[model samples]
Target: MRPTVHDIAAAAGVSLATVDRVLNQRPGVRHVTREKVEAAIRELGYIRDVAAANLAKGRTYSLVFILPASDNSFMYGLNAEIRQAILRSPAERTDIRTIEVPAFDPAALVSVLEELSREKPCGIAMVATDAPEVRAIVDRLVRAGFPIVTLVSDLTGSLRHHYAGVDNIAAGRTAARLLGRFLGPRKGEIAVLAGSMLVRDHRERLEGFTSVMAEEFPDLTILPVLEGRDDPEIAHMLVADALSRNAGIIGVYSLGAGNRGLIRALKEKAVDRTLTVIAHELTAHTRAALLDHTIDAILNQDAGHEVRSAVRVLKAKADGLAVIEAQERIRLDIFLKDNLP
Candidate 1:
């Protein structure tokens, strides 16, 4: 039979109240007494049933997810997964809410975060805008004892408790290697498309991509990045213009959303030319493009996994529990035409 708190108290030669205080990490328990209880717990091989305890205490984790208000397919999928989590909130004893901030707006995000400092939810997970003011506010909130996690995109130097997203630098390096290897011996400029440099993920991806291209593939040149704002119309126009003006461009690297516009531009403008393209995210547009030979490969991160991991980490931090790092590490996926899933 499993040992109970009463047994633990008896073994440690302490009162039941003392044992309860130690177990709950409440003040007034002397260090020596706490050590005795811990030793007794170890000797009895006691495992805490956190779920039962939370239920008994009527604990409800109030978590907020701050997502970017972008119209991209990946963002849509992420929002859908969060909605699904909300559907399961009742069973999980969680009160989950989402706040959609304007994409890449640091002032708006900082304002929301400051307001949340007053609101003081159990936890907050945000797609950071990678700005100094944003980081400052996040650090202030963390020092004020708010459990914070960065999802999808992370801040440069912040006191965020955890990050729930892919290693974007590694993803970009992988893209560069793939693009270079596919276009072996080709000497032409590569047109790069980005959503914005204000997000850490995009900036880090570009950094990695450029580093690899310069070191390993000296023959290929990366042109000035076109900021499309992740808008399909802007992406279409920018890419169409680039292809029209630059005849020496033989490859494309799209390290952001708006792949639908990129694909359309390739289909219309580069129909007579051969351009090897590598892109991020496995949306419908990118997947179809991969099959049709528009995009050579795709690097993807599971949106569902990221959302679940953020929720789990936030809850763990709020409860003052240790998170399993291995379980929370989001992985990168590479997809080609043959392996579409």
Candidate 2:
């Protein structure tokens, strides 16, 4: 069996990113790490010809960014990042176009994917809706020899070439731990606001949050998840309603976008009670809330980094080159009022 980069990563006890850096002769690696990877390569008798691989697959990429038509600040930031990538695409030898489908609408997204499949671009990157039909379309695209990369929200059980997003389960677990510590040992109910359970990212975050809360903070009970559809008005209404009904709800875990609404609802009830809020994204609204002590912590994934990473993955898959998994791994940034950038 031909040893792959995955095998090298395991043997060296290092990340794929380090292996790629070594294989491609890129900078940014410690001397000890480089020696370990080289030793592993020698032991396995492995050879890498990145130049030959690139020669076989010439550059000139046609990539598509299929994003949701969400009004939230996070989606806005994502689109902005894509635009920035487009500006830089010429030098990278890549051409990029973007399409927006209705947020949370499985049928709408399916129609768009089908249309793109016929065109057969070099690669397709999308924020997938977690529906069986959507998954089937992605599988079809992959089978048709198109490189499909899922961005932000992933499509599980599909033949996706790569995923450019954070580990949502870990994000949720972190949120739970922070909320538990902030709330102390007081007995109270917690409200979780999500975009929808249909998206894999949100579901994973919920699972992580619930599991950790149950194991560590028994006193903090998680209430039923409220689907806000990433809409500010909807989220605001749901939060207002939840707060009114359960006075014991002292903490909130917002696992999705639409935090503007959450902020509005919290502001309205800020005088009545200060709900310890931990939400995703570091948008203007969230930053303001954090500064004023309306929100305790902000869990963020860089929208710009995610878009650029997806582009790189798509280009690599199109060129039949290996991806640096560690380099492409999207980081989860934890933001506090003190550290606002």
Candidate 3:
């Protein structure tokens, strides 16, 4: 027999009202009491019938996901996940929509956020670039009672309710460890190609990579950053120029989008198989390049996981329910030619 909320309350040694508050994540419950109630729920295997709860509350959440419009593998993956969510919305009883703006443009993102504020969706998920104006816009949305979750990249010091992405700092450290070990004590120059410094993900990745390199692998020198803006043409041109200037470059770390340009530049320089290339995202371009020995490894964040996490957190927030942190955790996936999945 399924346990009732009353049973859960009895098991947790709390009053029925306290149990209700914990389950609904209402104000006035202490952290310790909340934890105790949650532990009891887990131990009892109590599952809240979300559909019944929604019906009882007369809930219909309208959710909007704002993404960057870029011709890159990462953006493509994110778009695919959003489409999947739209297809799955009927079962969850959600009205989900996606909006795309110009990539690497904080003003454009801010404008979209402001527009959404007027329209006032029940929940919002966005990939925020690090800018004071952008943060301010998110703050305004929060004050208006919209539950906001940051996807992929984060906006620090904002009222964002949750972050649905991997530990980027750990991802960076992992990348450095992989690159350093792969190179095997060779003293050589490494180039870092990023989408944009203005984005939090890029900056965090750079920080993590540099920290690992400084602490563990001081033999390799990282060259000045090349901003690709997630554009194939720009990435290709910049990489080619860098290669021409630095003949001893032995490794390349692509922490941004747009592998097309990187592939082209490597092929043009005839260094496709010579240089050890590590990049992010696993798309057709990166997959093919990996098979062809152009790219060595891929550090990827599953777009599906990010999108699903965002939806779950937003829905919970809208319902005034607590999120399951373990269920919503975003994991970093490391892919090589051997294990694609």
Candidate 4:
């Protein structure tokens, strides 16, 4: 039989109310009493039925997801997953809403965050835009006793409780290694297309890519990054211009959204066979590019997994419950032409 609170209270020599406080992670339980209740629960091997308890408590986690308003495959998928979460909201007793801010606009994000802070939702999960103002806002929210989760891109110095994204530095290193090997031992120049340096992910990826390229492949040269702002039109123009200037471009690494623009640029220049390209996200454009040999490899992070991870972290933090760190860690999914689903 499952251990009950009554049993825990009796074992710990505490009142039922005290046991409830300790068991449900409520505040004001003295440290000594919490430890005693915890020990008793451990001795009895008690497993908390969190679902039933939440239902009984009538707890509803109100969370807001701040996403970027970019017309990219990853963002689209992320928004879709949020909608799916909303569909499951009733069953889970969650009130989840999303706010779309302009892509790479730190000021706009800061304004939105400031506005949301007034409402004081249970928690907030956001795609962090790297800027001092944004960091300040995040710190302010944290100081105000809010649980925050950084999604997709993370901020450098902030009080965000968790991050629901890949290790971007490692991802960049991976892309560099793949690009280097795919290009063989031949010396050639590589061009990179990025969303924005204001984004930590893009910056980290560029850092990793350059570090690897400089250390491992000294013969290969990496050109300056072209900021496309996750806009296909901008990416197309920038990449097309880069290709024109550096006709010896043997490889391309797109470490951000805007693959459609890259594809359009490649098509406009008819670069189907010459270049070995690596990009992020396994969207339809990229997948089709892989199938047709436009892109050589793809490094993907599941948007759905990120959304779910953020929800889990926010919900757990809101309830002051410990989460399984290992279970919540998000991974980067790599896809090849031969291994794509």
Top of the candidates by lDDT: 1
- Per-prediction CA RMSD (Å): 1.9, 9.8, 5.5, 2.7
C-alpha displacement of 280 in model 3, angstroms? Answer: 0.8
TM-score of every model versus the real structure: 0.93, 0.80, 0.82, 0.89
Model 4 lDDT per residue over 47-156, tens place: 77788788898989999999988867788899999999999999878999999999789999999999998999999999988888999999999889899999988887
- Model 2 TM-score on a 0 to 1 scale: 0.80
Worst 10 residues of 3 by lDDT: 267-276
| Alpha carbon lDDT at 221, candidate 4 | 96
State the TM-score for model 1: 0.93
* Residue-level error in angstroms, candidate 3, position 246: 2.3
> What CA RMSD would candidate 2 show?
9.8
**Leading candidate by TM-score:** 1
Which regions of candidate 4 fall more than 4 Å away from where they truly are?
21-48, 271-273
lDDT of candidate 4? Answer: 0.90
Count of clashing residue pairs in every prediction? 0, 0, 0, 0
What digit string (tens of lDDT, one per residue) describes model 1 on residues 102-205?
98889999999989999989999998888889999999999999999999888767999998999899988988999999999989999999998876788899
Off by over 4 Å in 1: 27-32
Q: What are the per-residue Cα lDDT tens digits for candidate 2 across 192-282?
A: 9999887778899999999999999999989999999888999999999998888989999999989999999999875678679999999
